[model samples]
Structure formats: C-alpha cells, structure tokens
Target: MKNSAMIEACLACFAACEMCATECIKMISADHLRCIALCRDCAEICALCIKLEQRDSEFSHDVMQLCVESCTACAAECEKFAAHHDHCRECAEVCRKCASECQAA
Candidate 1:
C-alpha cells in the first residue's frame, strides 16, 4: 500500500487505541492505570510516527522503530487485561497490527 494510506490507517488505529485506553483508565474497580498509561503512550507515539512518515523526515525510520517498540509493549500490557475486558483485547490486536506495519514502514 502507499505510504499515505498506511499512515492514515495507522493514525486511525492510534485514535482507537487512545479511546480504548481512556475508557480503560476509568475502570475504577479494576484500576488498570499502568496499562492505560502504556496505551496512551503508544497512541501518542503512533500518531507522531504517522506525521514523520508523511513529512518523509530523516528520522522517520527511527521514529517508526520506536513506534514498533512502544506498540509491542502496549500490546503486551493490554493482553494482560484482555481476558476480562473486550476493549483491552481489541486494543491489543490493533496495537500488534500497527506495530507490524510500523516495523515495515
């Protein structure tokens, strides 16, 4: 796929992850603050990577590599809560997929 399209998809996934993370943060009974933090970080990084790719920046590769690492970490964290939370499971899946694409990018 084209770089623009890939970036668009990544950005969309980032938004979804961000929203999921926010909702997860509100789980007062579960208190998944740590996982929510990681998810929020992942979302920010992913969005940044998309912008870097769009600009064709010199550090695009490095940023994308960072994005992959962040997403992987977020995915792992999300997976821990996935069994009990539908949003977490969906967030994990999206993070994994986005990580793969970021690696490819």
Candidate 2:
C-alpha cells in the first residue's frame, strides 16, 4: 500500500495475531478458543488487506474497512486474555494500531 504506516501496522498486526493464536492453541484451558478464532480471522483479514492494497484493487478501501473491523474485534478478544498472556497483550496492541491506521486510510 502507498500508505506506509497502515501497511506496516497491518503486517505487524498479522504477525502478532499469528503468534497469539499459536500461544492460545498451546494453552490447556478452553477459555482461549474464542481468542484463537478471532486471532486467526484477524490475521487472514490483515493479510488480505495488504494484498489488496498492494494490487491497488478497486475494492481495496472496502476491504480495508472490513480489516479495521476485524482488527477491532481481535483487539477486544485479545484484551480479555492480556492480563495472563503476554502474546495476547502484544497482539491487542498491534491490532489496535492497525485498526487506527486503517480508519485513517
């Protein structure tokens, strides 16, 4: 994407989400299931948004909107586990940043 900040944010968010999902999967409790799903969805959406932006697709803006929503949702989910999970805290931070960048774009 031409917007470097948004692009970087998305990339960072994607990586964070992926890492958080892996950590959640390794947990013994079922409480992490929802967080895992949200992280996975957020990661995919962030990646897709990056690709769409790179291609300069006509629907990129629309896709970006969805990306923002996904990030927001992921951030909320991650925040619930942030107190105990360092990965979730990091993921939530990145997702929030990405969502802000997407909204600005």
Q: Across residues 2-96, which tens digit of lDDT does each residue of candidate 1 receive?
A: 38645865786698688878888687745688788888888888888887887878988898898888888988888888899888898888888
How far out, in Å, is residue 103 in model 2?
0.6
Question: Highest TM-score, which number?
Answer: 2
Residue 11 CA displacement from its true place in model 1, Å: 1.7
**How high is the lDDT of residue 87 in model 1?**
86
Off by over 4 Å in 1: 1-5, 29-31
Clashes of 2: 0
Tens digits of lDDT, candidate 2, 15-60: 9999999999998669989899999999999999899899898988
Task: Indicate the residue-level lDDT of 66 in model 1.
Answer: 89
Error of 1 at 70 (Å): 0.5
Among these predictions, the greatest lDDT belongs to: 2
Looking at candidate 1, the ten consecutive residues that score lowest on lDDT are 1-10
**Prediction RMSDs, each to the true structure:** 1.9, 0.9
The C-alpha lDDT values of all candidates are 0.82, 0.93
